[model samples]
Target: MTEIPKAADADSVTEPASASTLLARYLHRQRETILDGQIAAGAHDDPDAVADMVVAARRARGALAAHRKTARTQPEVHRLIEELRWFGITVGSAHELRTQAAWLLAAADLLRPRYVRGPVRARISGYFADRTRPAWIAGRELLASPRFPAMVEDLMAEERLLRSTVVPGIDDVDNTAVLEALLERVRSRMRAVESARGEDTRDAAMHGLRKAIRRTRYYLESVDDVAPARNAQACQGLAAVQDLLGGHQDAAVAKHHLMQIAREAENAGESTFTYGLLLQREIDRAAQYSAALPSAYWQALRGARVMADVHLGSAAE
Candidate 1:
C-alpha cells in the first residue's frame, strides 16, 4: 500500500488566504518555469530538454484549468487559457512522438542481448532513430513560428492583468468551497471511469481515467495548504493509480507502433521476428497493467470516499 501523509491534528487550524492571491502566485511561478523551459529548449537540440519543456507547459496548463472557474468572466484570462490549450496540443504532439521513439530505442537496447540478435537490433534502433528526427523537426518548426513568441508575450501581459484584477468568486478566503469543488470533480471523473470501464474500446477510457487521476492529484497539491492532510494522502493514492495506468497506456502505444514497424519490415523483406517479439512483450505488459487496475481503482475510490467525508464534515461544521 502507498503511504499517505498523516493528517495534522484537527485542533491546529490555519486560515488559508484568498484563492485569487494563491492563483496569482501560482501563475507567476508557472509562467517563469514555462519561459525557462522554452529558453532551454531553444538553446539545445536535446530531446530531454524538449521533454522538460513539454512537462512544464503541461503543469502550467493544468494549473490554469484548475482555477479557470474563478476567472471565466475575464476575457483576458479566458484568452490565455485558450492559448495554453493550443500550446499544449502543439508541444504534446512532438513530445508523444519523441517519447515513443525513445521508448522503442530503449526497449531494443534492453532486449538486444536476450531476445534480438545481429542486424535486427540495429534495424530496430535505426527505425526508431529515424522516427525521432521528424518529431524534432516538427518541434523546432513550432518553436520558431512567430506565434510562439507572441504567445509568450501575451502570457506575460495576461499575468500582469491577473495581478491587477480581483477574481470575484475567489475573494472568499475560506477554501472549503474550493475543496468541495475539487472533490466533485474527482467524483465526476470516477463516474466517467466507471461508465467507460464497461465499454469494449477501453484504451481511450483508460487514458481518460489516467488524465482524471493526474488532474485530481494536481488539484490536491495546489490546495494542499487549504485542504486537510487527508487530501495529500488521497494525492498519493491517485499518483500510484496514475503511474499504473500511464505505464499501461505507454505499452499500448508501443505495441501499435511495433505493429506498423512489423508491416514495414515485412514489406522490405527484412526480418520481422524482433518486432513481433517486442510487440508481444508490450501486449503482455499491458495485460499485467490491466490485471492490476482493479486494485488501484479500489484504492483510489477509497481515498475519494474519505475526501468526500472530510468535505461533508467540514460543511456540517
Candidate 2:
C-alpha cells in the first residue's frame, strides 16, 4: 500500500534548491496524492478521495500558474495544467453536490419540528440525490475513461521531466515575485467585488475573489519549504478568507436549489412553508459570511506580505 505523505513531509526541504527543483518536488507530491486517492476511492466509496484528488490537481495547477514563465515555455507542461483543470472539475462535481446536500440536510435538521411540514426534508433529500446520481455516474465513467489514465501518465511524465531537467531561466523564477503577483490578483479581485454594480455581478466577483484567494494559498503551500512558519501562516490566513467566501457561495447555491424545489412543491400543491424558513436561514448565513469578508481579507493580506518578505531565490524575468 502506498501511503499518502503527511503535509509537513511533503513541503519540507532541508537544503537549498532551485526554483525548478522546488516545483518538481511539489508536483511529485501531488502525483502521489492522486494515486493514493485512486486507491482509496476504489476500495471504498470515499468522498474524501475525491476531495483529495481535486485538491491535488488544483495545487499542481496553481504551482504551474505560479511559475508562469516555465508553463509558457514548456508546451507539455501547459497541456498538463489544462488537463488537470478539466480533471478536477469532472472528478469533483459529484462530490461538490454531495457536500452541499449534506450541509443543506443538516440545516434542515435544525428546523423546528412544527416548521418542518409535509415531506419537505424528503423532497430536499430526494432532489439532491436525484441531481447527484447522474453526476456520480458520470464521474465513475470518467474514472474508467481513457482520459483519466492519460492524465495520470501525463503527471508522471511531467514529474520525471521536471526532476531531470531544469528549463532555461527557470532558476530566476522568484517565489516572492510569483506570490506577489498572485496576491495582487487577489487584491484586484477584491476591488472587483467592491465595484460590482448588481447582485449577479457582485456574486460573480465574490466567487472570483474566492478562487484567487484559494490559488494564492495553494501557491504559498507549494513553497512552504522555503519558510515553513511564514508560509503556513500565510496559507492559514488565505484559507480563512477562502472558507468564508466558500460559505457564502454554498449558501447561495443551497438557496438556488431550495427555490427550485419550492417551485416544484408549489406545483404539486405541497406546503412550501418549510422551504421559506430554510431560505431565510441560508440568507442569514450568507450575510454573516459577507460581513466577515473584510477582516479575513485584511488578515490574509498581512500574512502574505510577511511570507513574501523571505528571499526564496528568484528566476529572472
Candidate 3:
C-alpha cells in the first residue's frame, strides 16, 4: 500500500528534485553496475534477477521518454509517468519500474480497451498481477521515496487497518478470499444504490465510483494491479457518462434539499421541481454506462495483467 504525500510536504522539501534526477543519477547507478560497469557492491545471490530489473527499468525509462516526447497523447501519458515517479525517483529495479510502468500500460489499455490489446496491455498486465513485485525493490536502499511523508503514511496505514486494501476489488488471485469478499461488498453496494437511485442514491453511487477510480489510479504504478485493456474504452465511456450524471446528481442534491426547506416554510415547491429535472437527467445519463453490458475490470486484467510485486536481495520471475 503506497501512500499519498501531501502537497504541503512537497512544498516543505528543501530541494525539489527535477523530473530528470532519477534517470540522470539513480538509474544510472544500477545500469552502470549491470551493463558493463564495476562489480556490484554486494555478493548478489541473484544477480540475474537484479540485472533483469535493471534492464526492465532501462526499457521503461526509454519507453517513457519516447512516449512523452512523441506520443500524441503526451499529456495524459506523461502525467501517468509523472505520477509513477512522483518522488522524482525512478527505481532502477524491475519491480519498481514495472510497478510504475504497469500503471500507464494498464490505463492505456482501459482507455482504449475497445480498439486493441497487446504488450501495450496484457503482458504488462501479467506483470501487474504477479504477486511477488512489491517486496523486490523494498530492499533497495536506493528506493527511498519522498512520495509519501509521515502524515500521509499514517493516514494510509489507518485506512488499511479499517479496510483490507485500498481497492478491495483488486485482481489478486492469491487473495481469492478477499476478492470474493469484495465481490459481495460490491454487490451489496450496487443493490443499495440501485434501490436508492432516485435522489440520494445517485450522489452516493457517483461518490463510490469516484473513490474506485482514485483507488485504481493509486496502484497504477505501486503494484502490478493493472486494469485490463479489453474493457478500457467501455470503462472510460462509463466513467464519461457517469461524470455528466454526477454533475446533475450533485445539483439535484443541493436543490432538493434547498427546495425541501423552502416547502417546509410554506414556500412553493417550484425550485424542488428544478432539482427533480436535474436528477431525472442523471437517471438518463446512467443508462449509457450500463448500455453495453461491459464486464468488470478483473475480466480485463485476467486477459491482460494481474496484481502483485516485491523482493530485492534475491529476485524472481
Candidate 4:
C-alpha cells in the first residue's frame, strides 16, 4: 500500500497573511516533500518513496492549475506546471508496473490449485519483471537528469513569484471560489463519464474523473489552513471517489496485460484458459466498482457543498 503523508501541523506555522502566501507555502511544502522522496528513492528501491514523490508532484501541479488564471501572463509558470506533470508520470510508471503485477498475482493466488495451470505465476512474474526493470531504469535516469533539478528550481521560482505578487482572486482571504471552480470541473467530468456511450470512452471518462478528484483533494489540502476541519472532511469524501476509480483503472490495466499475456501464451502453444479466467475476473471487479461509483460521487459532491456552506457561514459572521 502507498503511504500517505501526515498532514502538517497547522499550529507550527502562522496563518497565511494572504491567499498568495498560502499558495506559496503549499508549493514550498510540496517541493520539500518531493525532494525528501527523491533522496529516499535514490538511496534504495522504495516503492513508497516513488509514490510520495509522484503525489507531491501532483499536489504542486494541481495547486498551479487551481489558480491557473492568476498566472495567465506568465509562461514560466505554465512551464513549471507541465514539468511537474511530466516528472510525476515518468517516475510513477515504475511504481505502477510493480503494483499492477502484484495486484494481478495476488488475485491469481486466490484460485484453487486445480484451476491454476501452465506456470501461470512464473509467467506473470517474469513478464512484469522484464518490463519493470526497464521502467525503474527510466525512472532512475529521470531523477538523475538535469531536467529533474531544473524542475525543482522552477518550483522554487514559482513559489517566490506567488509570495511576491498579489494574484487577485487567488490572493483573497477566502479561497472558496477557487475550490468551487475545481468542484465544478469535477461535476463536468462526472457528466462526461455518465454520457460516455462506448467502453473505451467510459474508461477514458472515468480516468478523467479520477484525475479531477485527485486535483480537488490536493487543492483542499493546500488550503486546509483556511478551514482545516471542513477541508479535511471534504478531502476524505473525495478520497472515496478517487480510490474506487483507481480500482477501476487497475482492473482495466490488468485486463489489458492479461490479454497481452494470453496472446503470448497462445503463440507459444500454451492454453490461454487461465488468462481468460483472470481477464473475466478483472472485468467483474471493474463492473463492481462502476456500479458503486454513483454513491461515491454523491458523497464527494455533498462534501463539497458542505464545505462551501461552512466557508460562506464563516464569511457572514
RMSD list, candidates in order = 7.7, 3.7, 21.7, 4.0
Highest TM-score against the true fold, candidate: 4
Query: For residues 1-317, could you state the per-residue lDDT of candidate 2 as single tens digits?
Result: 23333333333355346666677788878887887777777677655468898899999998777677777887887899999998888878889988988887888898889988888778888888898878867776777677877887887776566656766535655566777788889999999988888756767788999988888888777667677887788889999898899988988888888899999899889999999998888888877887889998998899888877774332323
Name every residue pair that clashes in candidate 2: 172-314, 172-315, 172-316, 173-315, 174-315
266 Cα displacement, candidate 1 (Å): 1.1
- Alpha carbon lDDT at 105, candidate 3: 49
The C-alpha local distance difference test score for the whole of candidate 1 amounts to 0.66
Better of 2 and 4 by TM-score: 4
Model 2, residue 81: distance off in Å is 1.6
Considering every candidate listed, which one attains the maximal lDDT? 4
- TM-score to native of every candidate shown: 0.77, 0.89, 0.29, 0.90
| Cα lDDT for residue 183, candidate 4 | 86
For all candidates, what are the clash counts?
0, 5, 23, 0
Off by over 4 Å in 1: 1-16, 67-78, 92-95, 110-118, 168-200, 304-317
Residue 75 error for model 3, in Å?
A: 38
Query: lDDT scores for all predictions?
Result: 0.66, 0.79, 0.35, 0.82
lDDT score of residue 86 within candidate 2:
89
After TM-score superposition, what is the CA distance of residue 317 in candidate 4 from its true location, in Å? 6.9
Off-target runs (Cα >4 Å) in candidate 3 are 1-188, 191-213, 224-316
List, residue by residue over 122-178, the lDDT tens digit for candidate 1.
Answer: 666666667667766776677778767666666666455445565555553244555
What is candidate 4's lDDT per residue for 1-317, written digit by digit as tens?
A: 12223334232355445667777788888887888888788778755468987988999998778775654656787788889989988898889999989998998899888888788988899889998888888888888888888788778776776777776557653566777788899999999999999767888899999999888888777777657887888899998899999999998899889999888888888878888889999989888998999998998889888887876776687
Cα lDDT tens digits, model 3, 178-234, are: 223333443454455556546456556655643333223222222222233423533
**Consecutive 10-residue window with the lowest summed lDDT within model 3:** 306-315
